[model samples]
Target: MKKHIKTINGVDYLGHNALANNKIIHIKTTPSSSGKTHFYWNKGRAELIVGSKVHFPVPSIAHLERYRESFFDVGRNEIQIGDSIVWFFGKPIQPMVCATVVGARRDKGKRFLRLQPNHPDSIVPETWALYQPGNFFLVSNNRINRHRAPANIIYAAYQDELNKIEEIYAPIRTRRIILRYLTNGNLSMGEKAFKECHYELFKSIYSWAGQYRKIELVIGDRQFPTMHPSKVEKAMREFCQDFSNRYLRLVGNDRAKMLNALVYAHKELAWIHPFEDGNGRTMRLYLELVAKTRGYGFDLAASLNSKKKKRYYHFAVRKAVEGFPRILTALLNKALT
Candidate 1:
């Protein structure tokens, strides 16, 4: 039998091409299966099953090392040819491993492949590369890349404005308005009226609160000259129409269902880049509002601050362009849940 090595997190295991999932590669061991002798392919955890056969092009040792550093609690094991294993689960299984195969050790034994943790060939690797850059942008520039500095500044300013809004309203309702403002600044007339009514009711309590401040705006005219005012307006209208239509069709009045609905909607809206100034901020705000309405409130600022933000954004883009919502939806569910 040909021998191959497989790794997860940092740990290395041996397996062959028979282990790889047709849908995704980078498999993860289940938390419940920690320290267990047998491993399996897990979509949720990104693990490959022990004793699974995998086929891989040759991989370098450096590639193996890079893979382990990206994920936590890495391991490796081996598998033989002609072995069949479960790839994904319909329901959560205790002591079950759920991971995508990230890498495979190839050309080691005659006709055998090895699985490596954090494989560059894995989907998670591509997603992680995208995620990391987004993280760096947020940390260094306080926003995601591809936006003009002015837009980022405007977004920052709006966030400050939201803070002021909170001071003048009930915490719950204030949060809801902030969510709507972030998602779509121009709420429907009725929604706007509802927010204004709440604002009036609490004016006495927060009369001293000042107007939202402005950040120094940077223009993207030099970078994306085609993004003129007219183009922006068109984009916004399209975005609004799509969002409203989708919301009506898919979103339920309940909270949990709405949460899922918002996740999908946010992905679509982000792709639209409806606003000339603050789409990222808006999408997050939209998601937050949907969450709050459903009683599953979130602090998106904190979530966006994490390294995973890049992964989240990449997934969103992929879902928008490629029609693959699995990774994007999974990440959103993970974030909210």
Candidate 2:
């Protein structure tokens, strides 16, 4: 054998080995400190080097890359709260499950992640687990079957929308613009501001970004029903009128009453599901602008990808689709600052 090279997780390492013979070899054990096992071909035999130790001739190079992407040395700082991850079971890597990273901490210099199963039926030993390289992987490149989009793609879309919001709608100016229409009782102007959020966020991706959905819309795996295509315009008009009346009536000293009105408007607009896509994103942005007009912070628009927020949002949106606003109202109460 001459010089051997290996690549793992986009990093390459080189090693020189002279076996004076020629036969292919492989190994099937835990990788060394370098996270890769080197193969040195010789005459009818090969060397299997794991760390400073060597095991004899074994398997094949095809199996070397089997779990290559699974053993990334993710830094503790790289893992953020509310990130999605997947954990593998025992040997052979079967029975893998998806989970959300809810918390993080260090105990005695060892990092740990607080995980919650994405599926309620999933069985996990503990909420906290050691941050080991081979035990779990972030869900960035994994393709979701339902939307057929990678998790990283979904996160990128959210980040793009957030960046646009900050660019086009600075908080003070956004608050001024929204309150102008609200205080003047100009529902048309308010609706334009509402739809503009969708246009600004998705005009490049969807031609119909600012328009109402012309086709029937369904939400989530449960197939939550949105308003019929024919009724969307009328529903939105009625919603705007109702929201205008309530906002004017409740914009006084009672912050609690104002929050209730804002929550009601949010749930009603979600029920309408005006746009073909990005209803949730648009609604949250619109809600934030409205909240800013009332002296509340734009918290919901920024953290839409949070796992806990996703859980709460799905539950609240389900109730909204079913024409029940209580759950969504409660969710908004918690979200609005």
Candidate 3:
């Protein structure tokens, strides 16, 4: 009697939720030749036999309708196995195809659905599409392949990408020699030194280590565009020239001038965002090396602990390059030993 729930041929079929062991639970009517109808819950896709005749017929239009309503609606948190999805590629003229959600995986707070196309000629069956909000719509669920399901299939598959990045950084935190190798290099402040720092730290994990990012990059909630790849080299060269001229000369004594140059250097490099990854780590290492060049210790971690500090730093990184480095100067002053 519900919108999608229906009883057909003496068996009650509910939508979606009654699924387990790849079978829909259906309530059957027990035949006793009596006026009273006795209820029985049956679990199977096949017909139920009461008196040598079929009680639950093979899937009808009502069953098909129930399957249609079981798909994951856009923006819904709970994604179930066999939920239908339709991927519309680009413009309206492009072919829209139907795929069944065979698996769901999470990376960095976003859900990705591993889909199997209904037809072999459609989109690649092995594709994992990102399930972003407003990107998908409901289609018919797969009722045919219900027999081949694996045991104990849970819907939410979460693999945090940050955890993988932390795994790469774990050894550097625990070991002193690794830290020494990173910070003790006598490389002069230049583009080569910056690339080398990125390489030495992340070459073990990333193939693109020390390489400038070819693709476009946007940072944080504001989606601030870092320097385009075409302009990265030019920006880095200019920053290095300024760093060598102004910041390097003031390294030992003039704390006021040195800090001002340091703030500019930090702001410029962060805006450039040269490498695809490890830019933050590389910048921190560069700052520490700058401190060491003058026989002083600068612990950048001291100023980066609080949420408010991080929020302001994120704002300053973008704003400082556009205007003045006032907030960044205040933040960097805290890092001085």
Candidate 4:
């Protein structure tokens, strides 16, 4: 279960592998004779159906049709894997909840999916009180309720809630655009390709979303070399040509060699700091594409889920900025296959 996701103001958005139809859901389940868990979808609760009939008002599988539809939004914009959904009940304690679509399946005439919750073990008994459309304004509200879901999604409710929510989900929308490129016949990987995706990620917010940064910037005490706004075009040209060279040079999976190549490309891109804010995120996406060149799934899930590893990732990237890329190479090597 490789997971690539991040939480903004407590809302989780999927930014990883293309798992179709993921969302946050609250349901009860019971042991069915088939050994797989039978989830109770109605009433926003579920329990394992133990015995055939134990005098409980067990809802029929027919009733589950409605609940299943609510939990998983089918037939709505081709629901890719990393997309997110929120279900809020307008309560204080645990008013709003979000989740991602992890996996999907089709049985008989129905479609089913596996949803990964955005909560942790600390809140094991997490319950989402789903808000109906009447109480909330979903981003998808005016856009047609094609998913047939029972819950209303509101990603942010804090200050500048709508804008913040858009920022949070930007990765999702951007990832979709990149996914299309990856799956499309056009197999180009270079600065322009990355810029297109970066633009999608930060388009609504930044005027220079897709373009290279002007002037210069620093990270803490480290002042990175950023191209002057005027020279960005030529620098990017050389950079992309060099990237293509390195990618073409990738050979049989000598793990260390492959990793070194991967680390070098990422290090070079980050050093360029191509775009202002989304350079890091877009680079992560580019690295995934690089890994794909060698049939590796460098998913964000196993990469960003750990506090310790995140620190190490930063450390490795810093090492890459210098000449010492062994750490970053080693980290990326571990993520392969």
Candidate 5:
């Protein structure tokens, strides 16, 4: 029989992986005076009124030991206090899907994974603390071992957003490395290349660079509920393989089809939002590859964020959600020609 999901005080923690999206609802497992053990998740993004039983550890898993392989490989290294992890929701028959690790709590020698707050870890990791709990509350990427905040940072409490610094051109350093790798001729631009590109672009900024986003997010008003974190890798791989195979083989004056393909490519990247950050810039970079193959270039408008243009861009992206690409096609058509 399948393993029963772990719970504290009869609260079902493992419902769906998406439930742990951006808030690492870190709960403390405690023993009560009546000789019973109960849980209180009164820290991090979700503060459960001290004695309420309303949360999960890694979401959808009653216990982590049942699927030992998925939690970490054999002889797992010291899982750093704040390192990101992929939690497996071992669905029967259906292939297992993953959730991002956001927080962790130690209970008798086991590091129970805490998922990224349904949202957190924005441009700055410091901003993520409010969404996470426990000693995993961090400084930049390193988890703070001290119970209190750093002496230098203001409001360095357990639940404050990190300070924002200038946009330090994280892209320039990453762009250089990716360009060198791409020009090597042996690499066919596909999902692997996309992964490589994402890694090179943001590894300097965050450790979990190439991996998929750990939580689900909405771009505009639409939630896109079905687009959960676990499905990110599969969707991206399929897209990369299919698009590369076709685009690479096409020859002759297929400009119309090529532009349409460009629209499709852009739409797919935006639709997925695969990486944590740089999805927009990454989409453009990927489009540039598609263009490079066709002996031309694709450029996203610098002023694309202006009210007039962002509205249309957002509308086109939303339309792509429903598989309608005419408006988006026109936009790409203009950029390519």
Candidate 6:
């Protein structure tokens, strides 16, 4: 039988992964008798209140164990403070089980509560923290730790990259580039290869580059090439014109609307495969620019990968050909959110 966990009188504290149709879970905890609560996560520390829910997933047995140790694991199954309850599950536990009030303790100058159904006692503390949700472990596991850089080093690198772009470009465009770089690190150019290219120049004219070259571009696992050079040029021109017109209509001069327009416009442009080589890179960059213009920030590089790429590309194609923006919208929403 599969074991699942749930929490009562608590809020979700994090979101961990997007695998398996948004494989997400939550960290829910109760307040002290005085009604004070603490929030623990990798980014953006916040205060917890009654009735607040933060949903996230615990990815594996090891991750669950780590969470137990970090929060509770005070050499007991049940930990209580005031009127609140904290529970932990073991190897017999499954993703569906909700932990109840178990136990509490203080270690290394911090206080934590423990839950129940204790597994082996050999689980390490480092692994214990890996179980909390909200893209933290996956991002750290895949990129941060894989790169073997210290936390400060990683932050510095990201800040440096942001600074380089900010020095050379407008804030809006800089923000976009930052978002894209955060999401995916790779960038490609079709034929327009030059250093220090202005964001506007690339935005306005990159689609038309290499249009005269009679080549084909195919994405995902489709049986046919999605676009041929000759067809792409004509389609792109029409797409751009129509997109600009739509931008004016749907958003009607609102900056946020304009940014959303830009995202959709880039999505449409990507569908056209207007350039031979750099469509993917350009589309991502374009999306970043739009997002920055709208006061939104995201990390695309940290989210997408070779394993997820195939599904993403397939969704894009489906959006373009089937007149179904659901898949495309879902992807962009995921990125933006």
Ranking by TM-score: 2, 3, 4, 5, 6, 1
Say which candidate scores most in TM-score.
2
lDDT (Cα, tens digit) per residue for candidate 5, span 131-198: 22223322222222323212221222321221111022334654575566557778677787787766
> What TM-score, computed on C-alpha atoms, does each candidate reach?
0.34, 0.51, 0.50, 0.48, 0.48, 0.35
The order by descending lDDT is: 2, 3, 4, 5, 6, 1
Against the correct fold, how does model 2 do in TM-score? 0.51
lDDT per residue for candidate 1 within 1-337, as digits (tens), equals 3232343343333233453333223333322334322223334444333434444422212223222211222222222211111121122321111122233333434222231212232222111111111111111111122221222211212232233223223355555566555566555522333224334323332332121112222222343222333354455555556655756345555545665576656655554444333345445545655565445656544344555776566545555545677766655666674
lDDT of each: 0.37, 0.55, 0.54, 0.50, 0.49, 0.38
Q: What TM-score would candidate 4 get against the native?
A: 0.48
Task: Write candidate 2's Cα lDDT for 117-162 as tens digits.
Answer: 5544444533677778676655532112223221221122233222
> Candidate 2, clashing residue pairs?
21-42, 21-43, 22-42, 22-43, 23-42
What is residue 156's positional error in candidate 6, in angstroms? 30
lDDT of 3 by residue, 1-337 (tens): 2212343442212233323332333222222335323222233433222223334432321231112221223334434435455554343332343455544445688766666554444434456777754556543333223232111111111112222333334346424333564576665667776777677666543567778888778876577888899998887888898898877876667677667767877888888999876677777777766665666556766565676776777777677878778877887887765
**What are the RMSD figures for all models against the true structure?**
18.8, 14.4, 15.7, 16.4, 17.8, 17.6
lDDT of 6 by residue, 1-337 (tens): 2222433222222222232332323233323444433222222321222223434333221122123221222233323221121122223322111122222334475544332211222121212222222211111101121121112211112222222222233445545545554465354221221111233323322343333336666654455355666676577656656654666356544655655665566556655666543455546665664455345654456445554775675566466555666665555656763
Model 4 — which ten-residue stretch has the worst lDDT?
Answer: 40-49
Q: Pairs clashing in candidate 3? A: none
- Put down candidate 4 lDDT per residue, 220-269, tens digits, no spaces: 33564544556666777887887678654654666666666677777877
Question: What ranges in model 4 sit over 4 Å off?
Answer: 1-167, 221-231, 249-258
